[model samples]
Each structure stands twice: as C-alpha cells, then as structure tokens.
Target: MSQITISNAKKIYHDTPVIENLNVTIPDGTLFTLLGPSGCGKTTLLRMIAGFNSIEGGDFFFGENRINQMEPSKRNIGMVFQNYAIFPHLTVKENVAFGLKQRKLSKQELEERVDKYLKLMQIDQFRDRKPENLSGGQQQRVALARALAISPDVLLMDEPLSNLDAKLRIDMRQAIKEIQKEVGITTVYVTHDQEEAMAISDQIAVMYLGEIQQIGKPKELYHRPSNEFVATFIGRTNMIPAQLLHKDGQAYIRLSDGHMIAYPALNHLEDQDVRISVRPEEFVRSVDGPIQATIKDSTYLGLNTEYIVETGFAGRIQVTEESTLDEDFGPGDIIRLEINAQKMNVFSADGKVNLLEVI
Candidate 1:
C-alpha cells in the first residue's frame, strides 16, 4: 500500500516555525490535495514529503518505509511542477521516456511504458513534437505523461494547471482527475485554487497559516467547515453576528429581527454570543419571509442571478436565486428573505470553533 502518513511533522526556517505538529494521512490511490493561500507552507510541506526539504521533526512514511533521510530520486515518487518541466530539447516521446531511461529499463519495456502514458494522457499524436510546439494544455499533458510513465508509487503535482488559461485549466483538471482514477497512483496535489481543488480531489486538506484547518471530501468541507476560516475560504459566506441562546435544552441563534433559528448540532458550550455563516445560496427568496432586504446591486449570470442586499440589521449580504424574466430585482427594490437554518453554520464569536459537530 502506497498510503502516505505524516506524523507530528515540523518545518522551521531559521528561528521561525512554519509548520508544527502537522499530522495527516493520505489513503492509497486517492487524490489528496493540500489547498491554501500563498505563503501558507503548503508548498513547503509538499517539498518535505518529496524529500526536497528536510523535516525538522517527526516521521514521513509511505506505508511502513520511513523516507525523511532518503534521497529524492530513490523515493520512487514522480513530481510534476507548475511550469511543466518537460525538457525543451527533447520530443514528447523522449520526455515521457526520460525517467524510464534513468532507471535503465530495457528498450522494449521503456518504449511500451512511454507509449502507455502518452496515450493515457492523450498526447500520442504529438509524441514527436518539442515542448514549444505544444499548447499550454498539451505541454501540461506531456509533463503528466512523463511523470506517470515511470510507474512511480506516488505522484506529486504542484499547481500543474495554474499556468493554463481558465478554460484550459478546467479541461486539464477534468483530464487529470480521470487519469488519476484510471491509473490508481496515490497522488498529492498542491494548489491555492479552492475551486480547482474541489473539482478534482477525492479529499482535500485545507491549510491556513501553516496549519491544517480541516480535511475531508469536497462537499463535507463546503457544507460543514470546522471553523470560520474554512467556511469563508472554501466558499463565500455572510458572517452575521448573533447571540446563541439556550432555551429548553436546545441551542438557537436570534436574528436582529427577533427571529430565532434552532441549531440541532451539539456544541457542548454554554449560551453565548455566536456568528452565523450563511452562504449566498442558503438565503431563500420568499414573498412572505420574515427577513426584509433591499437590493443594493444585482448581477445576472445565466442560471443564477446574484444580488447584494441590505437588511434592517444584517448590513449587506449576498443573495442568489435562479434567474427569471418576470422576477428581476434591481437597485432599491424590496424583497423578503428567509435563512435556511438547516444548512447555515453557527460559529463562536471568536471564529475559532463551529457550534456544530465537525469531523
């Protein structure tokens, strides 16, 4: 099993601790992503796992084999970088065969392996062309093909799709997801793009300020984030300050308009001030709804029409609804809204902990 288990990993630069006490496990053959903003030590952690950076403390293991002191080349891991590091002097086929050649595989076996990934990445027709002759997406495919041709135990991708255009990035990400599933190689993908990570990963570890805030499947992270950062970073949310009141042995949040919404999730804390994390989609537009709002701005984007609305007490918040020809709301238009209490998240006033159970 090529599962990756990191235990109490620590990385320090000079006298500053960049990452400390980080523990995470990547199951075999699953596409796990380390996602966060820039300067958050995600790349640092990825390099540590790749053996390019020294682990100041803790164990880095692939199954049972410890790799902290191992050389990078001997780690049996394939790395694809953001720049698509295919040798420009070599043809596509030659680039795909580079690692196999380094291992001194027989010519027939090398050629067969190269051909397999070349076709798997669907760059076979461009096998004879140099890197410059390929489009950005095609070059990325060449890089992926080259990485997989060696049949490594694990694959590491660091923003491999960041250089491509938005449209091409979407296309290439879908391709990468399908290919990874087909090959079944344990992959650790690093990217700052939350949408890209959500689109492609089987599980994602959301990193923040050198620490992992949450790790779970895409939907789990989105619908039930562990903290305010994950709730705000993974997607857009309106943070409304409210009071958490315990009445009759149940938890509840009171809105500015005196509307109380029940929170069924157990938080084990006493009644106190809390914040509500309501996604734009969680706000329902109802003619007889309790919440009243005035439209500040609106943008129509095909399927969904988004609005910036101001309520009596919640200031300004985003609201989204399906676009319709007859129900278009513009500036100064009054509307009634209701919160989807079942989906909205209640967090502590300090934004450190969610009031609901988080796994």
Candidate 2:
C-alpha cells in the first residue's frame, strides 16, 4: 500500500485550466473517493495520478517517491475502467493471468496467482467462460481479478459500477469495498454518484468545477456541511430564505411568515439576509409546531413517506416521515412542521459563509 500525495496540481486544455492548484493526500490502504458532477475534473485528476495525463505543474508522489515523469506501466497501479475492459477472446483465467505473464513469472507461480485472484473475486467457477457467456456482474469480477492478480501498490477505479443495474450496482459496491479492505491496497475512486461515494469511501473529496469544495467522512460532510453548495450537493436540503435579527444579545432568524426561530447567538449580524438549510428528514410533523404548512404532494416509498409541503415561511419544503399505516396525509391537508435546531445549518445569503462557524 502507498500513500498518494498531490500538491499544487494543475491541468490545462488549450490554455484553459481544468484542474487548478489542487492538493490532496490519500492515506495508505484507505478508499478515497473523488466525488463531483460531470466535467468537474475528477477523472482528470485520477488519470494524472495513473500517469495517463501530464501535470501542468506541481508534484505527484507515492509514499515519498516522486513519480511525475514515470510511465503509466511503471507506476505499479492497477486501474479498473468503467466498462469492465476485458478481452472478448480470452477466458476468465487467461485474462487474470495476462499481467503475470507479462512479468514472465514461472508457470506454477503464474497459475497459482491467477487461481488465487479468481477465487478471491468469486469468479473461480466461471474461469473457463469467455466474456460473452458471463453476466455484467461476472464480467466486472473478472476485470477486478485481473487487476488484482499482480498485487499492485495502488488500485484506481473510475466509476467501475456505472454499467450495472441499480440492484447490481449496490451489491457490487459492497463487494468492491469488502475486496478493497481485504487487499488493503491504496485506492482512489472517482464517481459522480453521491450515495455510492458515501457508502464505500473512507474519505471523500467533493469537487466542483476544478476545485475541491470539502473533504471529510460521509457523515461529517452530510451532517455538518461547511456551506450551501456542500449541503445541497451532498443530499436533499430545503434552502429557506430568512433574515437574521438581534434582540438583547440574542440572535434569531425571522422567517417570511413572521416566525422567529432562535439560533446559536454566534454571528449576530442584524438585518442580514441568510438562507437556512434543513434536511428532509430533519422536519417533524407536530400538532403545535412553530411552522404551519399544507401538504402539496405525498410519495409513498415503502419505509418512508415523502411529502412536499408548501410552507408560509419557505416556498416548498420536502419532509420525509416514517410511514405509519394508520396515519395518512394527502394534498391540501394542513400540517405543522417543526425543525430540529441541532440539525439545521444557516448560511449567508450568497451561500458562502457557514453561520455556525461562530458557534
């Protein structure tokens, strides 16, 4: 396993900067995910680490060794592409043995290594089958086994589960995480799927445009987001417009419908406009709650019922409640919504400053 470090990395395309002054340290033997929307330079950064792209500036290091100019084959990194790039003509065992054969290992050692990885990936039963005869998940396992047969110092995956169905994607993500833990190889995964990143990553770097917005554990980023962009991007949030008011050394946010909600008396900027971020699950249906709303829509999602409520304070807020067969709410039904103060986040009107910082 190797600790990967990137400092002041820059990438340019036709003089336009795609990745600018990027710096991140991926710990050894940890699954670090680079998460962002499309064209956010995540794949670009991954390719740069794999020596597939040239760095415009800065250094890329693997555990104190400078590899800025090293060839891709010399990087000792195993890469799993999105489409499971396996040879159509080669059987599973043959494909897994390709890397070992390239290194000119002895016949016994090569066969042993290939067999070990085939079993490790749970594709041993289909070792004699070609790619055409295997399922998508099976093909993915073969690709992973091939990558791991050589025992690389680092494993890089670029949306490796994107091609699978929803159920298969979930199952394969768990398998990938388990295999990564067992192998203990330094892994760098790039994906735009927020749920996948949160489910499998040890640490996630949320990127936007060409910059990293925040880096933290999944729970930390989801619960205590630093800004509006981080809060909205990480999960579903209702951005409610509010005004900060100060009264006798206390700071509170006044809603549009004349509701005054006491907040942490941290940054007391009187008469300043702010936006409050509330998660869907943070609102509760109460009889005497402070905020009043009417249900606009309801979606029954097996375990939980999602309601879109039209509130007087905010325009439309989504609330998720645990489903109870006895209680049913429909559109136009009046309901009271109460916010969980501890779980709420307040940001500047421009969505740059996290007001909780002063708390």
Taking all chains together, the TM-score of candidate 2 against the true structure is 0.97
lDDT of 2 by residue, 193-243 (tens): 999999999999999999998899999999988888889999899999888
- Per-residue accuracy of model 1 over 1-359 as CA lDDT, tens digit each: 29999999999999899999999999999999999999998999999989999899999999899999999999999999999988999999999998899999998899889889988999999999999999999999999998888888889999999999999999999999999999999999999999999999999999998999999999999999999999999989999998888788887788876788877574356788888899999999998988889999999999999999999767789998899988878999999998898888888889998878744
What lDDT is reached at residue 106 by model 1?
94
TM-score of 1: 0.97
Candidate 2 structure lDDT: 0.92
- Cα error, residue 236 of model 1, in Å, equals 0.8
Off by over 4 Å in 1: 248-250, 266-269
Error of 1 at 133 (Å): 0.5
Model 1 Cα displacement at 97 (Å)? 0.6
Q: Candidate 2 — worst ten consecutive residues by lDDT sum? A: 262-271
**Each prediction's TM-score against the native?**
0.97, 0.97
Query: Distance from true position, residue 82, model 1, in Å?
Result: 0.4
